[model samples]
Target chain A: MTALASLTNHQVRLAQRLVGAPTRDNWSFTTEPVQEPAEGGVLVKTLALSLDPAMRGWMNEGKSYIPPVGIGEVMRAGGIGRVVASKNPAFAVGDTVSGGLGVQEYLLIPQDQINRNGLFRIDLRAGSLTQWLNVLGMPGMTGYFGLMDVGQPKPGETVVISGAAGAVGQTVGQIARIKGCRVVGIAGGQAKCDWVVKELGFDACIDYKAGDVKAGLKEHCPKGVDVYFDNVGGEILDAVLARLARGARIIICGAISQYNNTTPVQGPKNYLSLLVNRARMEGIVVFDYADRYPVAVAEMAGYLKDGRMKSREDVVAGGVAAFPEALAKLFTGENFGKLVLQVASE
Target chain B: MTALASLTNHQVRLAQRLVGAPTRDNWSFTTEPVQEPAEGGVLVKTLALSLDPAMRGWMNEGKSYIPPVGIGEVMRAGGIGRVVASKNPAFAVGDTVSGGLGVQEYLLIPQDQINRNGLFRIDLRAGSLTQWLNVLGMPGMTGYFGLMDVGQPKPGETVVISGAAGAVGQTVGQIARIKGCRVVGIAGGQAKCDWVVKELGFDACIDYKAGDVKAGLKEHCPKGVDVYFDNVGGEILDAVLARLARGARIIICGAISQYNNTTPVQGPKNYLSLLVNRARMEGIVVFDYADRYPVAVAEMAGYLKDGRMKSREDVVAGGVAAFPEALAKLFTGENFGKLVLQVASE
Candidate 1:
């Protein structure tokens, strides 16, 4: 058990409110003696951490789907871990779990915090620890429901997605392909674009960092975008809005591009296209579909088993202190797939 | 008919393409001898001309629901008239008709242009000539289907509408009230706001020109906006978006405020609220629901007959020569209720 009696916890806490893109100055790294678990509490040893764009939004002080992380508090994160010690009957030693485990070496989930924080056991036989945080986790569930329900992509229809190399975007493109759609992906850099097309089986991938998005969309989607699954909103969102086919469905999953903006978020100026084409733009939060996760997991597991879907995790070798730099990789387009920080080896 | 044998037509023609708002210099007034209707054609004397915000869009060169008005051509408009002469079996000399009669005193609709231009007989017993151009015409049809089909307001829910004093807004607010929704209207001035609430029976009206719209929405719709029928768009659309309830519906009928903007259209900055609240924003064109107009008109007529609804038309006394000046009144917010120019007394 790695001598839990002498364990010391290393944590990254919010030191200052971020103004724009997060820097090292915005965080504080500290070490403290590990506290004993309270009665009925469970202590989890962090194995891996998920680095996401949503973490940027959680750093800002404003109204969002969830509350902002306050200064001096541990930064919130989604991760996989092994229960090292447990005083609760619901959990036991050596049981693997996944939840909002914060960016820390060890997460001591007091009894009262377990339910609200969503701690649950995961089967290692189903997938690797990194895959659970990728395709079988939040990103996977987000793409499954958002594309199938909100996008409603019909067979033979054209589906274009922004941020196609990111975790959610990768899942969305592959799922749309399985649903019999002509999937086009918009990603940064030539490598990411090639990976999405060659590896993920997308029809075409637009390298937005290299050329014009409007021109690329015209060349690839001659029939126009019937469904646009947007993850990186901003000018890209406006560009897609301009090319919407009649009755197009735009699913607003996230706006990673605007998350680090010092100025006001740039809204899509071409939204009037919705009126001209009789289209709709809607938004979705994955947490809203928590009850249906099992159904999506089962379907995705089948796709994985049959080699119809592929999942990739870019695992950065570092402990808990690597969170800030790992998160920066998302905005810089350096992360090629689902980015995960290895807090410790299994 | 008053001296039909010696009838001369006064017409307003587009002299130059408008850059932003239409100035008098952009139009030319001319007089010409009325031409005889061709074989299977119908000649009509204009009774009342409907002045609309959509005229601004038609002046610009672009693809829309209809084609743009060409230079030196008569300005497009919808009006009620008496069929003075006809060669087709579908119409008689005394038949009262409604169609795109243009900004002219007399309209000679040739055979081939009849169906495409929408020449149809209207019952005088159902409404006054001005009322037909207001409550029983395009604006009413827009409000009926847009609010019912797109907005889909449930009883006791809050429905907020922009451009509350305009032709479509007044109808939308009243219909929402009839559907048992708590209706709030946003207009430019106190007088127009008062008329919407006191005359049209809207639950509340916010004078957008006088104060903050966000504060007004908070004061009126404490439960958050369930349906937002956006006619003005721009900042008002953003304000209403910030107050959307879970599963809210935003019906984008028009963007009157942005129609004349010299700058690019301002998209709703708070559109992410749609994601936070799991809401939808959709666009509707009234022309799409042409086949269902009869059902809407019958139901609206019943509301008028029982005194459950009221119709108001701000009739400006002038012929086609006043077309430019009358349209200017709409952008200036100088006209109250549905602005209709009286080409001639009925």
Candidate 2:
């Protein structure tokens, strides 16, 4: 983490604007000298990278939560790191922190943006450094609030979740179980589905890719789905819409399946059921409830401590170069649970 | 008032089913002699008939709130009448009542069906009989609860309503005003626009036929709309969706513009904004809140008495023969307010 090593930093940059779906060729890895920390900045060596499905939406040339990474800029992502150098009073040398370090070996983060928003004190002993980006990080917070605050899971209510064994999905199912709801997960295959029911204690798991989801869901959820926590939106969403119980609520946490879609996203054809059953379908962004993060984090952490909440980390090794492939795991459903890229040695 | 009109009579039969839209040609205005009331049955002499846009949806060959009016039976509607005779011990002759008496001069209502649901009993002296069918009735209850419960208006928020000068729209805007919100209305013409702003005290009004609604809305509600009480749907909905503030709520009371469409209801093109803004759009059936009607009616009545609320009745003077044309007025927005047919004298 010396000046000499930082000078040879190789960073991945957006080589060309994606006309349609992004391919591996769109990124360029080049070595460049990392500059010294400015008056109110800190130089950090990337230790871990958080690969999120939201990165795809950020790459698209349209309005979203955040703007698209410019053609020659470093790919935007969250990364856990150690402050190798600093000009700020709060962050000193060797302080373990998280920030928007991008797809790079080193980052010069501004002082003002280095607090609770992105950069947080890391506890390596709690689980693993990767777990910070998984169980205790953005995906965990998303699952916690999206289910607890928005899904409003009541005891004995049948809760169905799409992308059930993935990052946010894994935590969502466990949380629902903790709240005394009959949690049913919709995952991809026998292996992942088995893990959800066995490891996560979900009441049932549907291999959405293996059989007819609508029929499978109906068979499992005889009372009908009271809360549908949707992540992967498409035909699966349409299937869930059909089986919604009276006063059901569909929570649109994320739509990973439709994010990389080349064409426009299709509306759920069976939305009229919202009228028939007097149900509601609502979209939510995590940032809207940022103020309540500590409340959600504390509750989720308590479950994590008592073995009530199970955590899964689909960790991809080989540092920042591993980010792009790790992110792709979400769309392809390749990763088993929370997808995170190990950037540097502990 | 005895059994002279015998056999609990005077029913209008639906002679034919509607092929596309129900017109005069699709109906036969024939009457049958009244049938005698069975034990615990109350005979109602129909006074005022409520004509609603939902009647058109009922005529279509699909599932809705109530079954399609049978080809050989009387058309269903909410009506206020005088209970000329009742066999049930709880009811006596000359008790003013309101119930689904079908579109006819006289109806032999079952005491269990009417009395069990508490469908009858009205104090005519408190408000005009027509007002019960307007502001103090279903339309008023719909506008009141649909906005307050679903829309959840906050003080200083801006509310924009489509079909703004119509029965529900006018009431919704007035209620938003009562909640300390700025209100803007959308109607079809200059006259309706003038009535909404000048008479109803809506802060601003937009004539959809006169200018660009999206632009007009931007100019008027500079802060962006928080609650959209939509009665007329389609393009106006799209325009409203584009200008919604963050965390806005859309109350789908009724979609008058798209009711008669032979094709499927197309999803809004700008619906992604809901995800972007983290907003909610909910469809409501007033009957879902039937238990709370008396509470809503009493509050709305208070508003009516205090001069904070006014009911506008577009009374088409005629008997059951005027039913076809009176129903058509809703689709064309020809009826300025609550469209009612004066079926008989009180």
Candidate 3:
């Protein structure tokens, strides 16, 4: 219980807004003395932080699904943590939890702001600390609701997912398969593609870095794509739009490819395909499904246990300072799966 | 009864595929001797033809909702006509009809290919022949189904329409107002704007040629747009996307703004707003509602008669020889409303 003067919480703060791909220069590493929780408050030690493609969005200055991280502020993030001290009756010391822990070693959630910070006890019995930050976290919730709600895939329908090796894509592809869909994934590089197909059991995976996604879709989804879970926007989205079957549904989860663009984001030139095919494109933000997170967690936990689903995370060490370099991996397509920064041990 | 001997048919054919905006050089005029209908067939003489923005897409060279107009082929079109000869028990000579008449003086529907041409008898009692080509025709069908089926507008909800003075836009806006929604329109000029707001009963109309559409939307649709029936896409689509309410639905009917573009069609840069708002964008094709056209037509025809809806048409004279110049008026925004070409006087 080092939520006191004895503890120094190291943190990464946004130093400047991004122009394109984020660099270490965009962040400032600092350390601050930790303080004990106030009455009705709880303090948690960050175990791991989720490094996501969406983090790239939070670094920019503009209106988005969530407010951008202000300069000189702690970079916002979500992670698994262990309660080190608690004055709240609801949260006992040593309770494992998941919430917005930021890119820091400790999270001091004030009493009035507990719910706002999304502080909640997470059961490690269903998943490990890192897995809690992966398949059972924000990314998982996004994939679950975005697919099942918007996509509404029918059995025997061909479901295509881009960024197949990434956090959200892995969850979406696996779940679409569980729902009786024929799953095809698109990822950069042959290794990621091979893993998504051979390991994750995707029916096919297109190596976008090596081949034309349009031709790959035509070959893999001969009957045309019934559901498309888009992560990478730009050309990949256009490719899927071209292959959409009549009544197809496209879920707009993230646009990792266009996040770093110095120029305006390339809008899907083939969006007219939506009209031609009588298809739909919809966007989803995971927070809207917060009320039912536990339900999704319960369903996914069963799949994880039965080996019907797999949660793969690429854990990066060096704690909070590693965040800037780690997040850059998302845009470069370097990380193989769910990228998590390990801040502390249980 | 001039189906055989003393009659000649003047026709307009596609001389070349279009690269951008169409010109007279892309069209070739020809004349041929009229031929009688075969067994179980019908022959119709074109009266008034519906000029549409979608015609631009039909002239392109590639896969689309329909096959592209082939080089040297009679240009595809839909128009109101008078049946001159009928061997089918279902049709009679002198019967008023509507179907795919092409850009020609006669539509000769053969046996077993009647339905493929979408040929059907029209009641002059419900509407005039020119009105049939405007509000009761393909554009009307597109607007009705695209707005009601895809937009799903509710009472008091704000519904915005682009290309407000055009064929589909007028139908959508008038119908939206009649259905108890607050209607905002976007058109190119002052006269069209004034007509759309005052004559068509739209709550407001933005003269895009005169002012900023984005600012107009903000002021007019203060509550945000719940349903948007988009005819002119590109930047206008982006403007509406930026002003979308949470859970908004956008009906993608046409992209007249980008139809003649030589460059890649602009994808809405503000499309990410869909994610922020949890909105959906979908496409609609009137042909998909062929079976339901009668239902929509009957309802709209009531609106037309009861004074709840009005159909405005910008009619052009010159028979079939004037199609090239007439259609160009659409892209130039010179046509104030539903543009129609008079192929033959009643």
Clashes per candidate, residues 3 or more apart or on different chains: 0, 8, 0
**TM accuracy, model 3:** 0.98
What is the lDDT for B39 in model 3?
Answer: 94
Q: Write the per-residue lDDT of candidate 3 for residues B195-311, one digit (tens) a residue.
A: 999899999999888989999999999989999999989889999999999999999998998998989889888888888899999999889999998998899899999999898
Clashing pairs in 2: B7-B34, B7-B35, B7-B36, B8-B34, B8-B35, B8-B36, B9-B34, B9-B35
**lDDT of candidates 1 onward, in order:** 0.91, 0.81, 0.91
Model 1 C-alpha lDDT per residue in residues A153-270, reported as the tens digit of each score: 9999999999898899999999999999999999999999999999999999999999999999999999999999999889999999988898999999999998888888888899
Q: Score candidate 2 by TM-score against the native.
A: 0.91
lDDT of 3 by residue, A1-346 (tens): 5527798999999999979998999999899989999999999999999998888888888878889999999999999899989999999988999999999998888999999999999888898888898899988998999999999999999999999998999999999989999999999999999999888899999999898998999999999999999998889999999899999999998888888898988889899999999999999999999999999999999899998899899999988878888888878888989999998877
Lowest lDDT 10-mer window, candidate 3 chain B?
B1-10
Task: Quote the lDDT for A290 in model 3.
Answer: 91
**Candidate 2 vs candidate 3: which has greater TM-score?**
3
In terms of lDDT, the best-performing candidate is 3
Candidate order by lDDT, decreasing, is 3, 1, 2
Candidate 1 docking quality: incorrect, acceptable, medium or high: high
For each candidate in turn, give its C-alpha RMSD to the true structure in angstroms: 1.9, 3.0, 1.5
lDDT of 1 by residue, B1-346 (tens): 3355687999999999867788899999999888778789988989989999889888989877678999999999999998888888999998998989999999988899999888899987777788788878999999989999999999999999998888899889999999899999999999999999998899999999999999999999999999999988899999999999999999988898899899999988888898888899999998899889889988988888888888889988878877888889998888898999989875
Clash count, predicted structure 1: 0
